[model samples]
Target: MNIPNLLSTMRLILSPTIIWLFLRDQTLMGYIIFGLAALTDILDGFIARKYNVRTKLGTVLDPLADKVLALSVLFTLAMKEIIPYWIPGILAVKEMIMVAGGLFLWNKGVVIPANIFGKVATASTYAAVLGSYVDRTIGLYGLILTVALSIVALFSYGRIFFKEKV
Candidate 1:
């Protein structure tokens, strides 16, 4: 019950709340929840590192929560036609590819701890999707940032691919 795990659980709980708020068209509440969730996202990492409380569960759950929250929001927004149709498609596809690769590596016994670039991409995605819930037009910059961060994350994975013996 460290701060990191608590924050991760908070995010997990927030996901369905966000979806319900979005479904009810309660855009402002959705934004509030999303922002709080994002703040917890930042706080969790700092708490984990600051307190030396990092756990394997936190390491795994934090990123999975991020992906689920973000991808779900993107899908919800796309379904509402609030943003470009292709944005979610591209992000989801890339996410799936990376996730599959990660699972493959893990099956072969490599933990592949999360990297800085992945955190950046997750933050940008939360920002972009939350922005869409408020003003749908406020998406371009976040989208661009997501792509930039994704590139960095992919490069890190590339290094693992090139260097890992397995």
Candidate 2:
């Protein structure tokens, strides 16, 4: 596998480790692992773009890794009583919708690339989850922002997808 694909795989591998650490009440260690995983995400995208090594596998695995990591972190935080259930719950619904939409479009022989709204939503999710480890207030705000961004992303992607079908 290429460096980008490898980095994405590493992030996927790291997801459960971070979740386990958090579940064990070792948030500090979890945060470190989470940071490393985030770093790998950034590095993978950069390396993929810079080296022209983006593969179909990388395209699928990169976002899959991100979703797994983010969902695991959010679920862990919610389970630890660090955040409210609705935060992850809503995000989970949004993710499910996005996945279904993506699959629908894929079945139609269309590929919808990640847009800025989705990226902002993802970053907001990361901020929310990470901030919860430090301060609940910041986490709440971040979660709210993530929800808003996710809505916008959903709308944006839906519009783009439907428009392409015409």
- Pairs in clash, predicted candidate 1: none
Per-model TM-score, in order, reads: 0.88, 0.93
Q: All models: lDDT?
A: 0.79, 0.85
lDDT per residue, candidate 1, 1-166, as tens digits? Answer: 7779989998988989988888899878877888888888899999999989998778778887887787777777767777666777777777787778777777777767778788878888878876665566777667767867877888787688557734
Q: Which lDDT value does model 2 have at 11? A: 91
> lDDT winner among the candidates?
2
Residue 30 accuracy (lDDT) in model 2 = 98
lDDT of 2: 0.85
Q: Residue 131 deviation, candidate 1, in Å?
A: 3.3
In model 2, the Cα lDDT at residue 67 comes to 88
